[model samples]
Target chain A: MAKAVAPRGFARERVLEAALALFAEHGVNGTSLQMIADRLGVSKAAVYYQFHSKEEIVLAVIQPVFDDMARLVRIAEAMSTPEAQQEVAVNGMVDFTVRHRRVTAVFHGDPAIDTLVNSRADLSDIIERLTVMLLGTDPDVTTRIVISVLASGMYGSATDPKLSDIDDGDLHQVLLDCCQRLMRTRGAIGDLRTRGAIGI
Target chain B: MAKAVAPRGFARERVLEAALALFAEHGVNGTSLQMIADRLGVSKAAVYYQFHSKEEIVLAVIQPVFDDMARLVRIAEAMSTPEAQQEVAVNGMVDFTVRHRRVTAVFHGDPAIDTLVNSRADLSDIIERLTVMLLGTDPDVTTRIVISVLASGMYGSATDPKLSDIDDGDLHQVLLDCCQRLMRTRGAIGDLRTRGAIGI
Candidate 1:
């Protein structure tokens, strides 16, 4: 049973990796099965054997990120306090986003991916769960907006060409620092206001 | 000369407004001149008379936003200090983004908009200028990333469905509060660390 599953799993992984690269470069609309097959140095039929359609391949490519997100949700859930859960969840998300920068870029800018993710109940459920964990039970508009900013800001910076010169460790540290600053719950805006950080 | 330009300008403005609505609903790639014309109840030729191509319409559609950004740069530049400039820039940007939520949504997610904006040096230059105004002369990765989060966060939240129930005034105040918290320049990360806001 192990042997039977291993080869299929290996092939599927290869297909997804190739498809992701193609999707990143040419976009989902521009990429075709033939190009993916060519990149893999395999026949179209072999590609079809693994994934029936381009949509399926796209779904497969995104599945691992969702899996990681699910794992993050589980880790956060095990934490004792709400604060602990928020910390674990935010750090886990930042690490996942940075580690998968290429995949994140594809997901970030692609309309096809947006439609697919939004339409899929499973994906949206995971996102809703992540949001709940991040914002807590009684989050206000400020908290929701700040959380959204923290996320997209991380994604945007990670994929920025200007910051490509910086090493990954430095980038990761900087992102975490900025995210933590944005994620501060108590007296953050008031402190900034008191210090005249924002002009009236 | 005024007579010649007035009618053309009015027609051009109508064409752009119609085009923006179609682009928002159908996407830039999915939109066409005929659709813009159909929406405006004008002939395709009349639309073409105002703007030669779909690309021209897109450029025209975005020009007002760029004009607002230019106005923001001027406002920031007139401020007395870098800190003042940062405050004004962040606040103005948040206001602009929230006020123009529909157009921001189109710009935020559309690949066609991305390609067009990136290709045009004028648009990118405005963005660079805005970044400089927000971050000052020499910003580290953290500052840059945080500024990005503030901007995209405002954009994301302004268009959020859950936040739709929020009135414009309430949404604006919440966004401002959140942005100010994220935009603190001096010892931001250090403050977070000292407060134990970030575990690391």
Candidate 2:
């Protein structure tokens, strides 16, 4: 994103909002800068003045999420117990995914991580930190697979044919239930749920 | 597939194998008939002579999996208990997925499922039947999400960056363990595992 002497937050928000809508409909790769400009009823130069490239627009749109996770990582790291850290990590991921369910579905449902966002080591590093906080370091092969499936499924669930129709709050609970089941860690909240419990 | 009077299975196999290889590298949509011919070291005419279109080639390539599931569905339907049927379904999927891990990755890993194979009712029907077998009738929303995550994860795990490197046997066991855990069903094998047990 280009920074102006007086950053027009209003113009930037419009561009980002228009770009997100277009991305949701046509996918990140399919949406063009021209289309975004057209959607905004603005000239290409006007949009260009805000964002140099389409990727920058996407980055700016998703920048809040990166910031959110960075803050979460800090909070989780400050905690002492693995269980507490994991709760924070898992809770943050589930809440964010649920809060922005539609957006997450659009981006992840795209076949390949478009070269648009591909090879971003910083994003991956944050995700990795959150993952370790959730599963702890040096987890066994089973834990890796379990968490991998849950993570993959959680992202895809928003766009899933059957799950899509369900309410977001219900979706969040079930996903957390799944994560807890697969991880099989009782932790402090184990008192609330019966052992081996599977419910909505 | 063209019904050659001779029904030359040998030539057909060569075409299908070449098409599969091309599809793996360049997704179903990216792989053209000509590319498959080039891979097979045959003329495009030869490839067209074997299958009427690229979709036909993909259909032929995945035909065996459909047949395998159909047969599995029959066996599971005959089982008396839901648990028995679920085991039959789960075991069949795991074994088939592990047995054909590379192919599964190539096809399922492709986004949009390729218009090459999209909107195929017969494939969806078979998958639905298999899902019903595994999930039983009228499962709760929680069960649906848990199984949804597991099933989605199972298909995608073959190509998942972290899980991809795992040995097939270990992957199979862990996936089954995850499924059984989320299902929370002791079934006939509860005795085999300790209560609420999760292991690789």
Candidate 3:
């Protein structure tokens, strides 16, 4: 049994935090509820009171990130122009990813998380809306490729242990700039740069 | 029992191809030697004859991709200038990823694969060399971030089922262009364009 720490805030929140840390270190399949309870310094019964199953806990852990994604989609959808939509969506995503790096890292390569995320109709709709907003209506292969690439970059860099030495503030800005460069068409590059969308 | 098809090259090679396809459809954990044998229309003993365990099968499946990566690293190292090195490394990576999208896709969200890949000292050294080649000698955070982002994009887009309708040639060119765009410094953008490095 691992040493326990005092529970913080809500019992639910503490369980999630403890689970996220364990999941990050040991992976989802490797983690057990007992470990989460041990980390929380609570009884296994206490942990079960908050969530019935490991899957439920997994869902709860990811819920906030999904909520943030949906919120960002809503905000981006209200923007009138594609450029504004793209800017808002990209910026929001980067901010969310940076803020939740640890949680996201835990979910990053886990297939169980992928299945759970894909099964949610609401999340799918949000992702579709976000995708359209980023690439506009009738996105071609080029647009899709560029957007996916930028996403990969943002997520990979944020979670990369190799980049631990870099400050989050600096990392965020550079990631944003790189994404903008990838997103912009050759013709729009000059205009976007002039509009101060490419960099801080 | 799967319907036996004529062996193409060697029994070992045939088993690997069949296993790769099955593994891609069902995850490594979800797949078994019995299934591979069934796919090959052979007995489980035959499958075992080719490879003793699933781990060995996985290694054989990934061996080609790793070989290609090593080859690319050597090619990039031979280049005289940093610019040349970056271009060669990026182009090679995109090409390799696109070519082996199926095998890569199977490996994509699997943690077991991650552990296996990371544990290999040779593979790690190859990846390190490839990263250094792409980012040059003394890469800043921005360079590292950009390289990682482009990488994410290439792999993600190449393996995405949603983009299946898009022709490989078109996807390849677009991916290369996006990678080049992410890689070039603002000052070098003009020079790279003039040199026709940004497109096919």
Candidate 4:
């Protein structure tokens, strides 16, 4: 509805909105600049004026996710204990995923991240940090899978079509429940890992 | 290794192998019949002789997964208890994923699944069954996410390049531990659902 009524100056924001909608539905690989232009009822050149490539648009689309991650990490850092940090990590993920269920479906659904520049390393880092924060240590294979399940569990299923009938409130509770259950805080999943970069 | 010397009569088998490789690397949407034929060093007509469309080829590629799911379900049904049934489901999944980590990555990674013949319903059914089997009941969102995390945790992470260095043996153990911990086995998650078809 907002896209239908936005005036001329909002083309960049409009492009992002259309691209996100297309990305959510058709997937990043399946979506095209032409599709975004069509969604905006504008010329491909006009869309091009704001962004040169699909890769650029995708980065802009997911930039907020990066911001959100940074914010979550910062908040998590403030927590005094590993268990508290784990709570922040789990709840933070649940809240973010729940809020943007469809948007996340694009990235987590197909890992279209690989198609982006070299963001795979960035994503691997985020999952790694969350894994460390969630468990508070260097993971054995078991805890590593915990992160996989914990991360994709909320991200993947939030957008699962079969569960689409499920509403947001219910979905939030479900992810919170699962992440909390799966988190097993152990020996030092804290400052030793993410903080201070090369800590002692 | 297998495709190199299978002989001319194995065009059908070779085509499947090449197509799977292309799908894994390029994704189902990105992969083309020409690409598959090129990989086989054959004409598109020859590839068409084996399978008329990419969709058909995809179905054939994942048919084994369907067969495995059926076999696992049958084996689970024979088990005397839900706990036993859940054990079969979890271990069966871990073993299959560890063995075909890359191949499963093709499907589980991008869910090129959506492109395959409405296997969305079929895939949803499989996830639902596994979720129910693991937890043994009609789930609240919490348990549903458990299956998502559990399934994707193993399927999504098995081929995660970051953890790609880990061997099959360790991957198997990791998945087993994660799934075992997550399966809570509550209420009557048993014959009332999957078996007897229309059971009371």
The iRMS of the candidates, in order, is 3.8, 6.9, 4.7, 5.0
Task: List TM-scores for all candidates, in order.
Answer: 0.80, 0.78, 0.82, 0.70
Steric clash pairs (candidate 2): none
Tens-place lDDT digits, model 1, residues A21-103? 88888889899999999999999999999999999999877888899999999899899998888888899888888887778
Across A1-200, the per-residue lDDT of candidate 4 in tens digits comes to: 77765654477788988998898778787899999999988899998988999988988877777668767877897899977997898899888887877667777755566546345677557665766787577555555656765676667777777778766765675566556556642222342244224642
lDDT of 2 at A23: 85
- Model 1, residue pairs in steric clash: none
Report, for every candidate in turn, its global Cα lDDT versus the true structure: 0.79, 0.74, 0.79, 0.72
Q: List model 3 lDDT by residue over A92-179, tens digit each.
A: 9998888778787787767678877789887677778888887789765566667777777788778877777866766676676777
Show model 1 residue runs off by greater than 4 Å.
Answer: A1-13, A78-85, A118-121, A185-200, B1-13, B79-81, B118-122, B185-200
Q: Return the interface RMSD of model 3.
A: 4.7
Worst 10 residues of 4 chain A by lDDT: A185-194
Q: Which candidate do you rate higher for DockQ, 3 or 4? A: 3
Model 2: per-residue Cα lDDT at residue B65: 71
Q: Candidate 4 regions off by >4 Å?
A: A1-16, A32-34, A40-60, A78-87, A109-138, A185-200, B1-17, B32-60, B79-87, B109-139, B185-200
lDDT of 2: 0.74
Q: What is the TM-score of chain B in candidate 4?
A: 0.77
